[model samples]
Target chain A: MAEDTNSKEYWRWTESNWRDPDIDWKAGEIISVGIDVGSVSSQAVILVDGKLYAYSNMRTGSDSPKSAENAMDWALEGTGMTQDDIHYVVGTGYGRVNVPFAKRAITEIACHARGANFMYGPTIKTVLDMGGQDCKAIRVDQKGKVVAFLMNDKCAAGTGRGMEVFANLLGIHITEVGEMSLRVEEEPPMVSSTCVVFAKSEASGLLREGWPKEKVLAAYCLAMAHRVVDLLERLGVEEDFAITGGIGKNVGVVSRIEKELGIKALKPTLDTQIAGALGGALFARALEQKGRKSK
Target chain B: MKANYGYKDGSGEFFITLDTDRCTACGDCVEACPYGVLEVVDDPVDPLSDVQVAVVTEAERKKIKYTCGPCKPVVDRPPLPCMTACPEDVIAHSW
Candidate 1:
């Protein structure tokens, strides 16, 4: 992190701003793969030279490692690339070591910090990685270096799986419930229970109460969003707070949080869920560049 | 009866090797580790043995028990559970 200058120009042209100058890898320039095997979903992000050309997000399935492999295959398939062109492979998230073929494994925190730094600039000091099993608050420096972090690893109360659970009960696709939430006409039933099991019971009671699907969806969204907001507050969440992981795509959740916190959260155009994979890809480039400079 | 069953390696480390590839990530190992150093990661369908992947199990002793005789024995290959009941399917060597 001390490797950078503390000047205004330095901040403008920060490490976060550095992209592989040769955006297009020469036909055979080595490609690096970052496979994030999360609990609820997995993704594969590939960087050829410096430009990100391929990313795929899929249900993580039942296994972290195999799911990571499947996600990688999907991404490679999308870009008309194959395993052979992948010069190096990295595995992160809960399944970092599960990619039997990966050359190295890294922590999810490191990957998210790097990715957020790249997309939002070095000034991004905080991140909310709301994956399947956990929600984490990460603080980083200008170099995309992690400074402090906290995670809610033991609970699924505010994660993708939490929503998936109720979505299953409602017989609705988890993807569509976000949009359905916007149609809510009333305050919806209040969900005060923090335990998912308790929440499930509460939802069951609401169902019996004849709460319409619209209001029920609204309640679910609020309960879930509140849990996330609580976690963010714990990490001393600051300006330029970015949201990543698969749940980041839920505009209902995103808008609610933005309104609740009175601060806008930043998101890049790529699949927000694949941010961890993208961060893993960006770190690979940094490692290679540093290796070159040392020689 | 506590007894020495095998030799240590170049690293002077001894462990009962389980064929992780052949072994399903059923999380039985997590329940069995007497030292409590294992936890099943979420989405256990295909478990990676390595990430926040693993942590020191907190049990009576927080460290991994290396030479709990009658249990794990080093070998040219790996070992399976004996007749001892671990309650957690953790390895045991009492015979």
Candidate 2:
């Protein structure tokens, strides 16, 4: 059988990295690194004396340890730094335990809360992390410790993976799905099914009924937004909420979630997806400081 | 307190809700589960509470959708073994 050469992976998102030119890592008293190995993606965050320095976001490969190493290597690409220079390492996300160099592994729930606190400031009390395989609603205290939390990982109805499947089904780029969903003429009724398999069939039926691609996207996004809202309500929303993870980049779902919750998520100055890894790095920094004090 | 173990993924919800208040740390559910998904553990929800409660094992929590799939049939689904073994009616499966 001849293999099709024209097939494209529409679900794949662009991976990238960034570093701060101003920061001198050698002068920093403590160099901490955080690696978040999620089911669909991996991110590495480097902090110098508790300040953001460099980071990388990449797709997670089948091997989680290799994915962590890839993300870390990319973050250090132009920094003139090596793994040995990192004083402490914290691993987070679903594959936290797989980070070979990490000094400690922390739950994504705690890490997301801390990361949201740092990125959005101390005022953020609620953190919604919609990751590849799971969605978590966390309530954080002033110090970013989890006060209450709820997680939904069994279903992919409102998660990033669900969005990716939709994008692939629509033969559109994953990044463009959010924008395209918003381009519809008016709001469409949400798809009834919360299960992704059923939702996909429903979407196909809508397309067969002559609904435009944008309208179908709108309906799917609305359904996702409502599903996420139900999860959030279970944990009870608080003031100054923030969103993290890949789905945070999807404006279609975010906007609908904001409308349904009647509260705006804080504008992020840093990449929202890095929240978990950043939080892990922050924890590493704290642990390093504590160790120094003990000595 | 009611603790829900297992996840709701794209396919369906496969949570086993355990009511801790009425649970007497009975090992019946653990014995009844064919997949070894249930276990008796210290009350994780309340540290002060001295009672042990039934919970889905840590390794099985993420994959309960599959571990518990055998008990769930498409038509004429029968009562789950774990739920049936719980004398206090403390276990419920949400499928």
* Interface DockQ of each model: 0.02, 0.22
Could you tell me which 10 consecutive residues in candidate 1 chain A have the lowest summed lDDT? A9-18
List, residue by residue over A1-295, the lDDT tens digit for candidate 1: 1233433221111111123344445474658778888876778888887567677777666877678777877776635567876767777888788987677676787788887887788778888888877776777778776665555555567777777777777877666677888787665655777777888888888889998776777887887777677656644778888888656767667777777788899856556677777777776665656556699
TM-score of chain B of each: 0.32, 0.91
Q: If you assessed candidate 1 against the hidden native complex, which CAPRI class would it receive?
A: incorrect
Model 1 spans > 4 angstroms off: A1-24, A27-30, A78-80, A291-295, B1-95
TM-score of every model versus the real structure = 0.68, 0.82
lDDT of 2 by residue, A33-145 (tens): 99999999899999999999999999899999999999999999989999999999999888999999998887787688788989988888988999998888888778786
Per candidate, native contacts kept equal 0.00, 0.29
List of clashing residue pairs for candidate 1: A62-B45, A63-B46, A245-A273, B32-B90, B36-B57, B37-B57, B70-B93, B71-B93
The root-mean-square deviation over C-alpha atoms between each candidate and the true structure, in angstroms, is 15.2, 5.5
Q: Give the TM-score (vs. native) of candidate 2.
A: 0.82
Q: Using lDDT as the measure, which candidate wins? A: 2
What Cα-based lDDT does every candidate model obtain? 0.63, 0.86
Q: What is the TM-score of chain A alone in each candidate?
A: 0.85, 0.97
